[model samples]
Target: MDIKQLQADIAAAVRGNDVLKCEVQNALDALSCATPKLKYLEIHVLKKDENINQFTNDLQECMKELGVLKGILPKVF
Candidate 1:
């Protein structure tokens, strides 16, 4: 190939590489921005799960107490 043609090819390749580098950098920045939000969402979900578990336990206790009260009291109907 002629020297001019070779230089043109090298310049095109360098531009392509720069474009790819920018794309990669943009993807990394997006992930960096999303990571903290993801962590916060995870922590919020865990807290809600804990609250649900506590509510379930409390409901179970109430059911047991109701059962005991039913045994102690007579039906009116």
Candidate 2:
């Protein structure tokens, strides 16, 4: 899965509907749904990204994880 696509899809999903003066409301809901997972992911990513040989594998794993996270996300946003 493309990380950029994931990001864009999330944006699209949340903005699925728009309310006057509340354009950010859906984004807020997306953040509420994703922030905790992002925090959890960032910790592991921080540690693994530092290792030269670990970058590729770690990234692939992260993508899989992110896919799962995304699956359950934005839907509620």
Candidate 3:
């Protein structure tokens, strides 16, 4: 999806119910794993790249703050 859509999805997921705890943790871990690439993207990409970085940062923050909204997939439900 697009950056704005992804950002909105991540925000909504972050505020979802507590059943997503493990997913949240996984998301945080995923962000950590992508940190280097994200940095590279910031350095080499254009203005559109900024949107990705912003979205990723927001996702990372949401994962960190909510702690229960990462992988709330059908398997969990």
Candidate of highest lDDT? 1
| lDDT of predicted model 3 | 0.82
Colliding pairs, model 2: none
Model 1 has an lDDT value of 0.98
Candidate 3 lDDT tens digits, 11-69? 88877755588788999999998999989787777777888999999999988766655
TM-score of 1: 0.92
Question: TM-score of model 2 relative to the true fold?
Answer: 0.32
* Range of the 10 consecutive residues with the lowest summed lDDT in candidate 1: 68-77
lDDT of candidates 1 onward, in order: 0.98, 0.83, 0.82
Clashes of each: 0, 0, 3
Q: After the best TM-score superposition of candidate 3, give how far the Cα of residue 76 lies from its true spot, in angstroms.
A: 83
Model 3 lowest lDDT segment of ten: 66-75
Q: Any residue pairs clashing in model 1, and if so which?
A: none
Ranking of all predicted structures according to TM-score, beginning with the best and ending with the worst: 1, 2, 3
Ranked by lDDT, the better of candidates 1 and 3 is 1
Tell me the TM-score of each prediction against the true structure.
Answer: 0.92, 0.32, 0.30
